[model samples]
Target: MRVFTVLGPSQAGKSTLVRAMAGLDKEAGQKLEAAGVVTLQPFSFMGEDWGAIEVAGGAENLAQAGPALAASDAAVVCVPADAEAAVLSAPYLRKVEEAGLPVFLFINRMDQTRDRVADVLAGLQTYCAHHLVLRQVPMREGGQVVGAVDLISERAWSYQDGKPSALVELPDGVRPREVEARGELLEALADFDDQLMEELIEDQEILVKEIYDVATRTLQHSQLIPVFLGAAEHCNGVMRLMKSLRHEAPPVEQALARLSPGGRVVAVGCMGELVKHLGKSVLLRAMNADCSSGTEMAGQAIGGLTMVAKGGNGSLAMGDLGRVVKSDHLRLGQVYLKDGARALPDWAQPRPATYRRLVTPVHQRDEARLSTALERMGEIDPAMEVTQDEATGHALLNLQGPQHLRRVIQTLKAEFGVEVTEDMVPPALRETITKPVEIHHRHRKQSGGAGQFADVVIAIKPLPRGSGVTFDDCVKGGAVPRNYIPSVEAGAREALMQGTNGHPVVDVAITLKDGKHHSVDSSDYAFRMAGKAAVREALGEAGLVLLQPIVKVAIHVPSVFSGNLVPMVSGMKGQILGFEAEQDAAGWDLFETLLPMAAQDELCSALASATRGTAWFQSGFDHYEEARRGDFGAK
Candidate 1:
């Protein structure tokens, strides 16, 4: 079965287009219709079984559509005929192109507008990497879009209200425009074919058969996009779309080639996992090779296999999405073969955790259950990060944003029956010494039979930031026994784990200068005690400094918001390193700076709000820097 993903901005009639094309609903013209956010529905046209994934619009749900895009054979990007609304397709188009999938541009809601087709096409050109060849030009009557001229067949069709388009003669004064558009289409195809270029350059006639072949080859390779238009709500031009797809859409083998090389059968994504009284089942799509119902793969029975089509319950074959039950080792996104297997490359890398929250189970007894549920969820989503902060003893959940975390929290309650509360994570702190100090400590004990006695003099000094704790033995002439020296260093290191400020001590150097050990009484235990006491005493005298982590941050956003960038960064006490034009992405800019970890929460919230959720950022821990007196009560 061939799977085509339908993508568009919110309210762009993507769901309507899918319904009309699939012959699901036909009467609801010119009204907003809400459908499933994500679903796979199979339809038939000319005895060919096909499926369409209708992805809900809006930026919030964009990340959720990754699975649909990865599983599809090709994609249809829907956009409105309005010039301004067409720009929303840029980001989505970039993703489809990156996946190496064949793309077809469908301009929806064309009947609502007239005489602005060229302007809308120009706006879309700024974003598309492939050349867009106009397959049809709009036909207007009484200043209303009534029909379109098909460039390839040199035929004109007029739309009847609520019915299939009827073929009509080329309208008067339309031949000049039709010839121009056809010429443009031929020129684009010629760029990839030498013979075609020669023929077009010499003003020679080209056969329709040759033209169709070149167009098919160019589109299959994703070098060019053939643009189609229709107002999907009226069902007008839907049949034409189905016809084009049947005749021109790249075959499933092309999708398999882009997914993996070689003749081996493979599976990339898990549509879902199900648990029943019988066993657990994993649904997956098989590519390039077929597996029968009784076949075994990776040591598991390929049972319960069925093609994802109209009432499909047959054995899975090449280019079919199906499922198998009771495979404990199977996982989503794992490539399966008859023997061993490997993992498929991720469609999109998990974005760095820009948002963090502290999660605690409300029932207290459900903590373990919550943790297990989070791990299972992470295995499926891969984008949600769950980690326990050893320093603060809080479970931190790292996700893309507030919306993402909200969904995770909801899943915890709905799926696992584990209730949890989320709050802002506090900044992690560190402690360091600011000055050097010298001290002498003696450990002594007497209990009649034996006594413990040890004396040591040590010097504590500060090292450069980021330099961890180090120990130096400067004892001369065997001032202290060598056997007991290791105990002294171990004691000092243990004390560094918890500093005077209740945080890990770092970037400090300790030197053991001189010490005394009695042969009869002195032992490793005595020396260790003396060492610990010495470091503790010296730390009290040394000036303690609280440190805060700084992060290197980069924000990628549209250049139109450049003016607000500086003020936002400066308000968070972040140092801006200036911004420049972003390469490859037009009208975008990259802002760079160093920001304290304490400012991350505020910065993330503000940037998302200001940019209407379009901007995104990445941050990494840079180094520990001294904190101000009022920043976190350091003094």
Candidate 2:
């Protein structure tokens, strides 16, 4: 059996195409409505069994598709017929190329479009690293694409509603177009074949079997991409696509060589864990060898194997996916061998979290339950991060985007039975002193038995940004006891934790100039009190300023939309560093900038709107800079 993953943007008919190929057209509509994760289905075509893994699409869910992509033998990229949707396939195409997986570009929903196939291919070619060769030319009737003429076989077919297309005579009007497309396909193949190049130059007729061999070889090597057209909703061109995959897609052994070199047994964890009535089943794919009950992989015995297909009979075979019901040690994206486990080098990694929100249990008593559920959620979706603020001690959930957050919240309530409230994350503001000041203070306590007395004079000075707090003792002649001087420094550092504006103080230095201590009443506690009081008084006279976190950002978008990013960044009070055309990704731009941390979410939203959800960015903490009082509503 062979495995292929279906990937594309959300609402691009990826699930519909999978169902169509699986001979489940009736369930296609129903499945699409609830499909938001990777789903596996098995089917046989032309006496060969195959598995179709449909990866959830969209920017929010793309990171979650990593495991499926890592384990598949080939990729079937479903693309909408519209030219505008071509850019949406950039990230997926990049991933496929990186994996070196053979790809079949299925331009779905062809029946609903009047655009030329060449136009759609042109748009997609800009983002694809491999040469795109159209395998079929649209056969239109009455201004509608009724079917397509296969360039290789020189056969024509008319699509039937929800059934296999009927073979028809080649139309005279389409013959010229088909010939030109076939020539283009041959030309692409000729680039890598001297014989084919010579044959084409000499006007020699090329054999169909030779063309097939070249197509398969080039595709497996990730040098050429074959394009097919269809509307999977009506089963148009579905059979043809399947037949092509059955012949051109690489086999299990080839995939093993490419994915796990020199390994005879390899299994990759996929989709995390699936909770069943029996137990928690870890979804995995057999990449090199068959696995069954009692099989030892990575030193853990496989309790049982349940194949993810109709009437599978609970057996796992090479190139197929199944559930390992008894393994407790496996994790998503882990590659297990007969003796040990290793990471899949080609596995896709989730993007960094850009949006965050504070989460709290509604009843306050389910805090522990929420924590456990979030841990489980993390195991399922590694892209999400759960953290706590050290200052505020508030639990926060970081996610890919707003949509990802919503889905996570929904899962928490529906699956984990944890109802939680969410709020905006508070800014991590800080304070810094403006100048130097000196102050003196005396600590005195009068009790019936013992009295405390201590005196200290300290100087506070501003330092450069990011310098943090520094402590120095300039006292001479033991004016302050050596043991008590350490206490004074400790107290001063603790006092800096909360400045006059209720934020941590940074980038300042404290010096203990002189102090007096009594022989009996003076103690660490007394000296500490004096140090705290003196530092507080000095800060009051030195003046304070608010500092907000700034982040370095790299924004990726199509070159056409690069102009919009300038105004977008400026609107958020960000500084643009530079921008240049991205290497290897034609027609795309990478913009580097410095943006305020508080505006990160807004930037994501704006880029999505300006680029039609085709933009993505990464950011990390840069440094703290002075913030305007009005910007943060701080007095």
Candidate 3:
């Protein structure tokens, strides 16, 4: 069984293409028809024939499609003609590459205005250095895209109404470029083998079988990206598409890792223990490590462990999740641990997932459905947890990316009855003290009821980073009652959180030196007042400075991107990690530097835009720095 994913921008005819290719409604049982040219159903080649599974355009669709595709033999990417729309394939392509799967590009909507086939050809040649072989070119007649010729088969097909007809001879009345296009395609396909090279060089006829074999080999190794020209709308060139997928696309690229059992449930995919993301499957094993179906997420699975062996090709297609096509001869599940697993620790919970903000309708009520939908998302990504802010009641999902965020909103409207929209919110930021400072809070309100009164004088100090809040009461004789100590700490801590710099306070310590407490009036409430006063007073008297979080990041940049990254990083007040000279086949350089987490504002967009989707990196918090101190801001 092999998995073929159809990737393209929304409404780029991807859904139409898949429906046409699968022959879902055909009474003739899945025949490949071209525009008045060919009615052909070649061989149906794939393992575990659960049939073609079509995934729609949405996050949930991706979640369902990901594992299915990951478990498939191949992926057929539908590239859109619009420049802006062409980007839809990027995320799916990255996911396929991570899964060790082979991918083929099918330039979609060829009937519409294409970006001069020469330009599309050139772009693919430059960026997709892995596998970019052109297998077919459009056949034009009367200045319209009437049909196309298969480069390997050397046959022309035309559309009869919407259905394809029998293979026909090449039309004579055609523009000069159409003939030239066919010759160019043949030359591209022939470059994969020496025999074809010799034939083309000698001006001799090359055997058709030889071309197919070479193209298949090149494509399997990802040396060929078979470009199919077609309008999925009219299903004109779709027959040839189905044929190309059957012959040239690789059978499967197995998940480099699998699930194994022993002392603990471990991830066995890709490199390290991390199972490369099979689309958006929930990690099988989470920190809250339970494997029961009720507890396990729908798309959720475990990753982030080591694999002892390289994977072989095989596939599985989930019914609701979709189907997998088999290609590689390797049987992975057999080698993995299907039993003898363990569970997570007693105190286990899912990881903290990030999300963008969403606002559902107010007058319209469907919160039950909204909650169910959000909970279902948890299966695809455990981190994609949901939370409704208490004050705002806003539906929020911690998402990984902008694409993921958009998909969630669409799912809400389409799947659930809730109408939801997203607004990318700037992450909540905090400021801390650059240096130790004395801050105090005082309160003495003597009114009618019991005459409440309290006075607290204490010392405020900052500790080393990450120590967290700690409080001590050093009242020698009973200046402040010992029983009210916890209350005082609470009051002081509260003031710290609402810092003068308008950021959270960190790495600070405070000591309650002395305070006055009345016999009847000096209750916990009185001490709380005293502690509050002391904190506010210390803050006013002791010098204060602003502090910010500094995140240590190790980025791998392609050597070519280093020069560009230098200026970009520095522009955001970032330090240039000069030790980025090394690079490999992945074309990566290792850079270690510290950046403000706050600087992460719009940083993801800038990085992706700069790298043109070819580069990505990870970041984590290192420590907090005194931002407003004397020269302390410099790294």
Best model number under lDDT = 2
Distance from true position, residue 282, model 3, in Å?
13
Badly placed stretches (over 4 Å) of model 2 are 24-35, 273-279, 310-314, 338-340
- Residue-wise C-alpha lDDT for candidate 1, range 162-195, written one tens digit per residue: 7889999999778898889888998899999999
Candidate 3 residue-wise lDDT, 1-635, digit = tens: 22355554346577677666655225212332211111222113322221343444432233334433433456666766555444345444444444445567777776676466656655444334354556666666555666776766767777654686357786665335555765675677667778777888899977778777877777666655677777777776777767666666653222222221232232211100111222222212121122222222222332222110111222112211111111111111211123322222211112223334655653356767677667654533322557775435767665545766665666566555567656554333444444455444456677778877676767777677778777887777877777778888988887777666555666668888777777776677777766776776666555556666677766554444556667677776677666554332233566666776656545556665665544445577777666633332322
Residues 1-635, candidate 2, lDDT per residue (tens digit)? 67788999888998788888988333211121111566777676666666777877877777766777777778999989988778888877776776778999999999998777888999898888788899999999898999899988899999999988999999999999988888888999999999999999999988999999998889888889999999999999998898888888888777778656776557877666435344345667787777777778887777777666444446577777677666766666567888877666644677667788888888788889888878766765667889986766767888888888888778778777788888877778899999999898999999777788899999999999888899999889999989999899988988898998899999999999998999989999999889988888888899898999999999878887889899999999999998999996766899999998999878878988988777789999889999976869766
Ranking by TM-score: 2, 1, 3
User: Could you estimate the TM-score for every candidate?
Assistant: 0.89, 0.94, 0.59
Model 1 pairs in collision = none
What's the lDDT for candidate 1?
0.77
Query: In candidate 1, residue 417 scores what lDDT?
Result: 82
10 residues in a row with least lDDT, candidate 3: 266-275
Candidate 1 runs further than 4 Å off: 24-37, 58-60, 113-115, 141-144, 173-177, 273-281, 292-294, 445-452, 558-564, 578-590
Error of 2 at 550 (Å): 0.6
